[model samples]
Target: MTAYKSREEVPLNEKWNLEDIYPNLQSWEEDFKKVGNMIDDVKKFDGAIHGANDLYSYLSLGEELGMVYKKLYVYAMLQVDLDTRVTASQALLDRASQLGQKLSAATAFFNPFLLSLEEKTLQSWIEEVQGLKYFEDDLYELYRYKAHVLSKEKEEVLSQMGEAFSAPRNTFGMINNADIKFGDVTNKDGEKVELTRGMYSKLIEDDNRDTRIEAYKAYYKPYVQLQNTIASTLSAAIKNNVLMAKMRNYPTALEKSLFGDMVPKEVYDNLIKATKENIEPMHRYMKLRKDILQLDELRAYDIAVPLVKDVKQEISFDDAYDTMLKSLAPLGEEYVSTLRSFKEKRYFDVRETPGKRSGAYNLGLYGVHPFILLNHQDDLDSLFTLTHECGHGMHSYLSSKHQPQISAGYSIFVAEVASTVNEILLIRYLLKETEDKHMKKHLLNHFIDSFKGTMFTQVMFSEFEKITHEKSEQGEPLNAEVFNTIYEQLFRVFNGDELVFDDEVKFGWSRIPHFYRPFYVYKYATGYASAIHIADKLLEGDSDTLERYLTFLKSGSSDYPLELLKATGVDLTTPEPIQNALSIFSELVNEFAEL
Candidate 1:
């Protein structure tokens, strides 16, 4: 709730203790130098690897280098995200990134060389070396990409271009985080101030209709002004994915993205199909929103405003943390206690300040702790965001603690389930705990809105990604107009005909940073559905589900994401989870209407 003029202005408790990572810049440099030497040492194994001992040596060296690389990259990344405008941190990240490209290039030959060996020979070698048994599963997994693995020479070349491959994403990150500026808005003091993402967040939901309209237009102005530029960046990113998929012999770009998790292309397509088939509830909710707001027409900004405006509660950060902990008691004391320690240990960068990255995320370093970035506004929405990210942090923490370094990290697919499960639990607890009907109704509205944002909107983005990527594969030109047209069309289709269109609405794709990641947003929807199922079971006191779910968290990438999720009795390969979630949404809308 307090304004922070600079990163220094934020309390030490609210800021991250990066010293936990490096202790000092000298240590970071030492690790950077260490990685460089390891990269050189790793390159020596290229042609020299002959038998089991050579293979063991290469794999072990690569694994150690990987641990160091993660620490370096994560430390630099946390620095830049805390304050993007710091050139020193930017330089550190740049050095770390270049170091990563070198590491990638050095090891790129290993994969190609790996697939070159006959399965029988590799198995014999695995039988020959005991250390290799540690890497047996991952080593065998490379065979899954046998057809996709390029020649050693080509792999090396591609790996050298790692920075270039990520250029568009980095460019967009700078634009979104450091360079672009929102238009001015009138603050509570009746002074015109430059609008920030943190300010726009609250202003867009202002009770004053005129203020909301002003904030909405102002918030979108910069994005609209730079639409063509952003369109070009996004177009490049999509084309790059298409090219990578083609080069790797994938049938489609979407399939290429899914291949890592061994998820069937049908799963991706089915998610979209099932959601569209059951989309009437979503459309009905929009109409309900229109009526509840008493508006002749709903607009883009109106979508996020709470329908139950009179039942506002000003929850502070400590209160929000306490509420989140109490709400998560169903997960057992260990989970709740571990989460509380994360706050006490300064693992979170909790305040929004000048040039800090907008939005919230939890990044878990396998060896280090999970660093969560939040722009806390000390309101109900912030409470939900806190619980959501803590889910991810707990997942990261538990997985790292329980699993080996190799399997400690999780895929994006299973990652969302952990976070969304926490969110649903928090909402369920709040809904049951509230004594006032008005407050309960407000909580219900919050749940539905969160559901809409997480499930429906992400599916819409997934489709948008699908369509645009297909356009690139078909050799159609992608530019500002094309992107705007596709986005506006999808927006209308998903939200139904109840809303009026604005110019700012069409440019929505230009503003989403996730679009740069290529075919990644659909997991949010799928995970939301999966979380709904898991959270409901937990609410019913299904101890078996809780134990399996906890084990699922610690399992990490030990198995494919789907297998991990299936182990918890939520099979995303089937339609039941999504349908169950949609049914719940319909029920919530009905209950909300009754209220």
Candidate 2:
């Protein structure tokens, strides 16, 4: 085994080329100060809007300021995201966020002013202003939420108080995930492994049961010790959601979140119901794991081991690039050509090194092409991550090319669909092309692992979130004991009679950052289910389906997510998509067992 080299050891030119965003930090600082000065100019928008014409001028000036602000903020955020520990980058991020808040407060009148328009008058003005054409849909969306729009002064207060109001959640993020300390664990070979959160996650996925158990216990002891404070932090965060919902006059915070995406409540409920009903496949798969590993019993820690380890395959970064291009061919030559450009342009930061972001993501800007951030280690997981993030990059590339800047950015509801679609397509391609039986079996197992994690497990977490939110709404104190109880039950439902849900796993909710965003985890389950349906269409070589899916990708915020998805022949409002995914999971489970 080799000790991985830290990023400092890697040549700077081969690393993240921040030169693409800015030539150097000094230039970035100059732009940062320019953006700071521009914020003062945005203050002019506060008193400019008195009517539709006034609103048009105000909006034009605001958009220009916003474009520059976006450029500055994106650079800062991308730099921070690449490695969050950089002190100067972190300071820039804070300043950018503060500037954003100030600008948002200044522009708060635009919506209320638009709401003041008579329906016919607003409609006429909408047609009259050529500058408003690209924003027609967003303006209409604002109109749709007119009833919920607070008075300008109240809205401005909310905007100004934004950073202060969310302090507890931010506090939790700092201490829990970033700076927490946990005990070290001894690996199978008797070497001490210092267990950071990232290392703990990778360790628990190890094939050795003892290594996983040791990692889990050592990693969580610190969280379990401070469970009360963690509970209070999360409780404060949840209460803030409830408070904001009440202030906005929404029925609930869940309603507030779903409305932003124009997602129906049924979409959430159906995901919960479909996943609960279909959890047997996951349970059966877990049982299979226990038997295959020849363990007396299965533990939560053993969930990530390969079912057949002797069939090993490793992919390098270059091989991954070529393989991804081939796997994406079903999306058409135009799509493949853009991916080729992404490769040639060195648009990806593809390697694992200290202090870099742990997971992988693709970030894109309006005027710029997408860039992917990864901690790649040439494993199956990293390969999947490359394709997944590429899905996002390609989606961004197409959307930016097709839609205007404002509408070019998409809602989070449909965000995961394209990525998962690529993952499914990639798996299908691998299985079809491989001649090795063991490798094929491993591929099938890999796909099953994806279904298990993204669909079944995420839906379970979503249910837990709903339960906790409902409990909090009833004024129940979300102490560790209560939180643990709810988590234990959900785990039992997903894990079934096969394994025990130790009390420690109850504190697991505290470890999941996604829970901080109310009702967010459900998207992963919905994304997985929806992607399967779209992948099936594309796999059958249906050009029309490809066209519709591409249209959905380019739609951005123009249409409701359900409407956009329906154009691709999948209605997330119904349970069909989730059920379809469950059926496919069943098929894959059976196929893997046979293999």
- What are the candidates' C-alpha RMSDs? 1.0, 2.0
- Model 2 — TM-score against the truth? 0.95
Candidate 1 wrongly placed segments (more than 4 Å): none
Error of 2 at 213 (Å): 1.8
In candidate 2, stretches whose alpha carbon ends up further than 4 angstroms from where it belongs are: 1-5, 11-14, 187-189
lDDT score for candidate 1 against the true structure: 0.91
Shift of residue 255 alpha carbon in model 1, Å: 0.4
lDDT of 2 by residue, 315-408 (tens): 7777887898899899989888888888777778776565566677888777867878877767677789999999898888888998877778
RMSD of 1: 1.0
Error (Å) of candidate 2 at residue 347 is: 2.0
Give candidate 1's error at residue 455 in angstroms: 0.4
